[model samples]
Target: MSLFVTYVLVLGRSLESSRGLLELLTPALELEVDDSPLSLSLHAAAIQLWCLVNSRSFSSSDKILTEAYSRLRTAIQDPLQRGCESTVLAALLLQRYERFSAVWNQHEQCHVHRNGALALLRQQKLDGINSKHRGYLISQLFHSEVNICISKKISFQASEITWLRDQDLSILPSNPSTALDIIGASIASHQHKFTLLSAEEFITASKPDLSQWYQDLQDTEDQLNNWPSTVPRHWLPQTLQSGKHFDQSIITYAGYSDIYPNIQIASIWNLWRTYCLLLLQIKLALLGLFPNLDEPTGTTQDPRIPAFKVKSVQLAQVLVDSICQSVSFHLGNYIEPTSLSELMIPTILCTSYHDMDPSHISYTLYQKSSLFMSRDDHRRHVIVQGPWHMMGTLSHVLSILADSESHIPVHALREGQMNWVRTQFLRVLRLLRIDLEDLSATNQDHCQANPGDLHALNTVNSEIIAKRLMAALAG
Candidate 1:
């Protein structure tokens, strides 16, 4: 896939819906196979597989997918023959396929493709492609790596990209996707470097000066606190209560959820809130990690820990409520599986940040976070772009949620995540009178959404879900 291919998705065609995407590709297929047709085929196959998985019926032994993969693999063997940009696109498509298809199988080549893409991008950057076009792929590769770092809980520099290091933060406008990515970068960096602030590491021979670690953490925290000031006031999210007019209901699970003109803006705001909560979680974990330390005297109880706890609870309450409030909007009439996937990452993480209290006492961050939503948020709908495994809204919401649950439950989620999933997520189900020990996320192996007949399935399910969801909210 050349830069033109990516432009087809981002700038050229209007992908207001999946049908628009299909229309975009119809013409793409007729073009001369000059710029890596295998790459386009790989992407097309991934989309077809996504449609199949969503359709709920399929039988080809994945031969089409397999052939596309083979062609992409052979093409990449001498990447320069077709160009590394095209290979990176194919690799990214493969990365995406692995994510949503995790329920069927975990492809080991997932990282092989990602690393290959990264290596090529790094080589290009080091050699200086000098073309602004390559910058888009670099930005995407940068975003992919950022997501991997945060999702995998690795340090910020864990996958250092030199371009990212040298990129000036101020040039990116304050509140859009770029700024949000920068925010994630900062938090991921802090999460990785947070080790210095740990009391357990204070005495370790390899540890840096303990005070400097605290200073850096404080600086990051301050930066985060001040980030919102940079955003234009009109672009910030507006709070809306349920009894108020909305696409779904008059009230929210926690009494209110925030609303935005569109999903991207919503995600941008939520990302900030979620990242802040995550930073607090990191601090809280450390405080609890060293609770019994009498030897550390003044060292163990940082002055900020108490404040962090209070702020965490307040943020959790507001965040969860607002997310639940907005869940229905995100679930509304229709959405693309890919859009739903992107929107729900922050939604799921917001709940996870507020997670559970092992002592089993304080409050549930996922509270009434929608017994309806918890079920859908994890559905593994396949999209070969990023890690969005979850159910789709209407059927769209249900589809998106189903995919989220599918990963590994099919890829976006990993093991031990269910440690808390078993408790909090199940609690939501129990309230709905459903018997479940954990999120269906733990049931990827049992999922059977094979795609086909989406029109029929969604037509039936959307009406059913819309009615029941409204009743549930009203009750």
Candidate 2:
């Protein structure tokens, strides 16, 4: 916790006085001459934005803003194509939103971050953009708007809520519980999705979020696909019979053959655990209220599964720390001068934050449609079934990492290793922190001692998650 606070202040102070930052404010803002890598460039830009946002003087900050805006305009107008133009634009926009405190005032010029974000959203809508990039843009737009509304303690517009709900329908995971109900002809006409309505809507919605009792289906698929031939037919029985060591056999049953599977699994789980912890830590740092967590506990008869679930939150935090250590360890081994290693924190944060979209859980969107309903029923759909959908996905990822034999060394990746890095683990590190561990652990423990029906409600990690998120914005 102290480490995070110290780092924040150190980085903040340095950002306010960086020579390169000052140079960026100069008439000529030069791109590094060497091909330093797009990730490096993006990270540099994020850091510059952070400094500007925390700057006391708007004049010093304006230079960064103008330069960044200029660079973005150039990219948009460039005749020669670039590799990640949309990413650059999105980064700039996120930086813009971060600069505006989570409040809106009519007295100030509406041309700054908040309204500018609204304009960007409108522009995307007008352009009919539907790519993944556009999806992220819309998500950020709604997210920023929501932040403003929450800060102001006001009711956001119904139309904007509808836009988010509808967009979520296409991008979020779906389930039977999120299906529509007959509120009234007029009321239903105005609002079809219950999730779009206020907190009261969730209370009244019928068949609430009864998606499933399992972990990530995608992970299940991946585990099956990557199954090692050496795994015995039964993991528990065979391992117990060996009496030599169940831990080694558990790894084998899951198809893991690494020399240090325990350490490896610990590292992986610790990374995620630390990520959640960091989120919580940041929340406390910012003195923000935690989010609500009233969802029902997932019912699974298997005792082992329940035990594992109980440790989910703690496990997630541990995983986050392990990830940081792993990445840092690898970076230290491969990179020279050591100074570049610190850059990984910001780079990983920005990149991973972009990866965990509610839309990614497109696999189980409509698993619980009525027998009478058609397979192609669109009305039954909902965007992310709930926040737990993501939790389940993350849990499954941890399970997969626990089972796999893939090694992520400093210099190179083993076969099947890059896939995990590409799909989930890397991104989780960016947007999460250590504090989420306690929140998750609490839920998991509660479920363990008293198991029953639990709706897929989000936990107290929201405020914490938001804070860790600010760290990314700092980048």
Candidate 3:
């Protein structure tokens, strides 16, 4: 009894402090308690508590996690004990990563543990774990299952995703804004991987059949332009402009500002927008990779879900909506005609410095844009490019997620009621691009003369506007 308590406390503390120890203990606990039902329950609970620590690096910690995970993966003589262990491990695995379907598939040969795990989670009447903890466990499980089903070509049940979004897992206080931030980060991490594939797709498309891929991309861009003025959800604005020259007004904090009033900043939408773009990029890349690739893309490997049906069309729409809504724009008007160093990187846009809006647009744009941009000068140039460019590089991941057929029915990514999301991204991009181009030309023409002249003109305009406003106020 004392040994168990010591193990619990020391292991708990170790898990909390060093992920390496947690990793070692995970499998160790599973092995030691495999025969005892009570021990299994306690170990599972401990695993959950351990997961809620500060160090949660998924890829880096996979070694230890997998080592521990192996112990709970066997076909045990006791079905009930095996099932309970499976449930706990499944929840842990899902919580750590969304690609559990693939992992599960790789180990499906051991059906006893898998079945046991599924049964354990499916049973709501299990004792020991409280409702709140159950919800958290289920939430993690759902997220993993849904995303895994999404990444693999599998069928999903509608109840899953709905359960996740609708389920009240409020064990802890979660600020709406902070929750959104976490969601954005999670989506972005996945989207970043997809973007990498998207870039590769671009390269592949550009290599030989540039016309086809480029044309397709152009068509998609055009479709994005036709979106309506209103955004999908939680998006600040649909359109933005970046002048040819660098900016200066907001540069004091926003990003770069070589010239004044050139950069137009606005929020795009939600995390979904990022996901959608990644999906599109992946689809395009896959199509580009094997133009005649069958619907299943035999080369794409088995579906993530055991034998679930996939939904490509709906998934595509979801991906598109996600990317379009999440995007924000930074427009440049009369930026500095000087060297690039004169321009500022968009670092001041973080949550810490979003209040530093020169145009007084509000906090929406400030927060959305600042999520990805950092003040680190060393990486300023690298981060300045738009989300599309970044997401484009990770096309594969987005493609995997966007490809509904790849998704297996997990609790999170279910085929919910279809909701229409209208957009005009392509049209707005084209319009803004043209407008900025003209402005750039005008700025260049103006630049033929002394830059002092342009500064003088701006000063005079400022004085006139200020005096007019002052007079009106005085009246």
Candidate 4:
């Protein structure tokens, strides 16, 4: 009945299943358990959060979580505790709790913990932390913070942390070079200080300048372009085809049975492409060569804009295809339940960016993702971090597609084809417990039909509907 007892039970179950995670925790658990009550509480809370997230037992895990937070708060009150090992561990535990719980209201608390962790890192300095447990916690906190900042579309203010930038790539077993590259790109994307351009300048390119902003962009672009050469041949996506139809096959990677490396490589590949696509868009926009999504009054006056749009579409297609391949490959492997959850958020983003057309592979891939999300337990895997929800991202993407349908003629499908896609997403939203009213009520005219009309009951089944929708779109 007590929080400790419940946590112990959950930890026991976790140890039986996840040897990798348990291995990561063993040093921390061993070093902390006998040190103090606070250390033990922090370790227990971190384990509980991880188990609850993978188990999808949000409701039952609240008691243990509450106790964890209460103890963390008490531990942080002493001024001398600022750079202590236990204090940093507690902050890291709270950060994990915020990530796993995925509650909107708790996001600010997540930020609080993030800031707390950064401050601790700044105070102690990375070299000062003698314990391997403390070092691992620091690395994780930095990784998680960078990811959080990227998802939120904000600047990572702690980009000045020397240790993170100075980390040796050769020392790391998995090679986090790609992750670091993305973090740099993310930080660069938000550098609006030197230029008069707003933070949203990347999207609109309202003002053009050649300052530190341009330099940062160029540096990131060079890094991305040069990345493939640095990758070991074994780590690279193997060529599946060699000749005329090479692009499609080149996008596919050789499958791996090892889930961790497979995920790491696939995620790095996808994120790199996504950022490259984004950078291209920004560059095209700056050069006044980006096509407007709205109805074209005349045949594209500038040939460059249309060409760039074609390139953009190609990049988006590659992103979607890569995600599908990653998912399919991972699903084929024997994986733990939560091994795929971390990939879901970025997968949703990449899929949404894809401009759907009958000929494009994205149409089929999107359908597969929809069906995946419709599974009974799949919705729990939808990660919630600031301004990003799986359903919300999906809805936003659908809205864009629906809007674009009115401007660019979609001759691939019969009448009401787009409506069916909308209905499919409506079903997904309902299943995920997201309110359709929130999306549709704001702009009733934004969608072709009311959410009320798009019910799951009218469809034969999700898979059949998906198949029919794909068929209809193809037609």
Candidate 5:
């Protein structure tokens, strides 16, 4: 959309000079400055390593990382001290560090760090660490995990689902993340455990408890319908219909999108719709929307298939609009005057581009169909921004000239609207060229090494990337 591309340019132009980003800290790391936080030397070092990664001091990136890993090895050796709140926070920051090293951290480094944080949190719960900080930590971790799974289309294993269901449900309903958190357990099960892997497997699996399975399905639908009402007025989004003057090339695949008070809130709204879209497909499959898996190739068609597509587009149109609108806030041309807000730009914008992951669906439901030349071809013909389009030439070559197609970025430029800002944006993208190329190369290795499964597949949307995306936006 012209909306997001413009804001991205505005922010990209300012990234290099935002040396003070670590001082502000992200929302999750806004720890009380008292002695209760990061007392241990390992925790202190982890925070320092996090700072090094974000300060754009790539010269020290490798050396300090080596030291961080050595200290982490030392800390992990003592199982008795592992469950402390300080330890969890340290692991979380190290997770941030792994995310920043786009060149080499690959899927393995960050995923390993994430598992470390999760394990530490699990241990804390077992040790009766019921403090407020622990609760905050767990919720943030769950948010990350859900995003990871949705972004990659990973099916949660049975053990992970069990862990999700057992989490604290006492979080206040008024909290923004709580709405998603409350039903996340159901989502985990719906996403993987009870999903339709195949018609025969599903039928066989549910036969033993058909009634309970349908009951769970009904309860999930109820939760989704009821979840929005529980939100406080300020947290709720304003619904707006598209107008005659609206740019069809941009947004409103449906007739409307949402207006949120901030990018964070908008991100949450988009995350919800993404989940809705994911579940819609599964629900449709379960209800026989796709062809039956057991029948001979091309031999069986569910009568509901045609109706399912019409309905899917109808429902998905608005969800698509909402997701784009959410990304729009992150690309703010006039949302706020402060650079601090820029530090929060996240993967809601970065991961919005796609092929809809073949592991999930045959058709690209989540991505706008406009990205392709025609419904029949599915070949990308338009020029869209790729992941971290803030990174240079390679992204443009890959996302625009090659696959991941759409003409949104081209349109953003053709209007000559933000011409002045475009130069600065490209400058920053070019600056990070190596990092982005390395990330792409490493991800390719991950795909080849673990054929058909990608572990560290999501964007590393580190503080540095957020800072770069926001830093150059002039008031």
Candidate 6:
């Protein structure tokens, strides 16, 4: 077997054994007598895709994906077969494959798989099944659905999954398992509220009742405030001390290698904060509040708006800075692909916020370096290779860079890195089949736009593209 396949089998086997579901989901040994053919097929296809991605064998990956999807379609056509645990497991594996291998425009298929998983859960009453493996699968599917909803600017199907709930901080002291359950559920709840607020109807409809919205925001903020006290100390944000050789180089400054035992959980905490900041931005936008360094002289200004903007910016900066500090630890240690993928969503959220400033000088330098350095040279020097999905995040980063038309000096970037970042952005857009002509017009409009106008424009553009891609996939 390929090394990538070997790693997947080993990791899957470990998880299966730990969950005490080895008999149900055997990942290590060859196809067992009791294993469903559909499950075995999915297991094989997932292994093949992993190897193909690592090896950059796109042709083979496409072939394997096609065959696996065919089998999946046939299996899911039968209601009885679709409702089985094996089919759910197969669906999860297929979703993983799509996430890693799907081309940019085809990403909506990930959501299709998520919806399928949810349907199976409902049909089989899997939520009532008290298996650890079932809980794991549910959590994974829940997170995936939330991510799709956020990324695509789609409305959360709240009515479809009423079982999700907010995290209960009171229970964390006595039960870690319940705490995890709450955390997963809470993420779904927050994402749902976020989607509701962001929907087109909410934005364009006649002015909403600000009172209820404000109360919801307060409730979320309170929950966030209460969250840190419940978690273990290591999962709380840590202050990174400057190393003795701090001034050695840009790379050295960016590389703050203080690894924590619970860095993964710490990353999740930071992600939650980032989500809060995003919601704050949406709330502020609804109230026509925006950061304006220039003093507003007109009577239209709300005196408190400036303070709110400052506070919002500060909170966003803190959350982003915490995430960047932890990046060094992730770089120093080995993180599985799944964990790394989880980390990318927060990074994307942080980068997408147009006004938040980078907290560390090194972070700014690293971004500058990414723009200036040759791709080959940067790859040779960088310690961690972020997953493929990170390309989408980088595309958003590139948009931010490009959108800083008059505010930032273009000439300041090193010629090579500027060319490189632009090239990569174009490459991503091309893969997504986004029109270059439209993007140029959008960029021109943004250049002439005010901060608030630009923010709205970006939001609309994102939603338009997301809707288009999703519709295309559905058709």
What would you estimate as the lDDT of candidate 2?
0.28
Q: Which stretches of model 4 miss by more than 4 angstroms?
A: 1-23, 34-59, 73-86, 103-109, 133-138, 156-174, 177-208, 211-216, 228-265, 289-309, 329-475
Model 2, stretches more than 4 Å misplaced? 1-91, 94-115, 123-133, 139-162, 167-325, 329-475
Q: Which structure is stronger by lDDT: 2 or 5?
A: 5
Q: TM-score of predicted model 1?
A: 0.57
Per lDDT, the best of the predicted structures is 6
Ranking by TM-score: 1, 6, 4, 5, 3, 2
Clashes of each: 56, 45, 68, 1, 7, 3
Two-way lDDT contest, 5 vs 6, winner: 6
On a 0 to 100 scale, what is the lDDT of residue 72 in model 6? 66
lDDT of candidate 1 over 1-475, digit per residue (tens): 3222332243212222111122234343443363353445555554544344244332442665666667776776663634544455566555555543432221222455556666766666534433223544455566666665654446657575645577653422222455556667777776665444445545463323444554565676787787777754434455544443332322124444454433434445555665665665555554444442322434545555565456555654554444444443333322223332443453222221112342422223223222112322322111221111111112122222232211112112223222222222222222122222222433322222421112222122232332233222210
Q: Write the per-residue lDDT of candidate 3 for residues 336-393, one digit (tens) a residue.
A: 2222332353432311122234454433453344232332321222223232222221
Model 6, poorest ten-residue lDDT window?
347-356
Q: Could you report the Cα RMSD, in angstroms, for every candidate shown? A: 13.6, 19.6, 21.1, 12.8, 15.1, 12.0
Question: How much is the lDDT of residue 441 in candidate 2?
Answer: 62
Give the per-residue lDDT digits (tens) of candidate 4, residues 84-182.
Answer: 666666665566456434432212233566577677666666555444445455555555555444444346664444456566533222334434544
- TM of each candidate vs. truth: 0.57, 0.28, 0.30, 0.53, 0.52, 0.56
Tens digit of per-residue lDDT, candidate 2, span 121-215: 45455234333344333434444443333222233453344455444444421211111100111121211221233366444444323112012
lDDT of 4: 0.40
* Cα lDDT listed for each candidate: 0.41, 0.28, 0.32, 0.40, 0.40, 0.42
Model 4 error, position 188 (Å): 4.1
- Between prediction 3 and prediction 4, the one with superior TM-score is 4
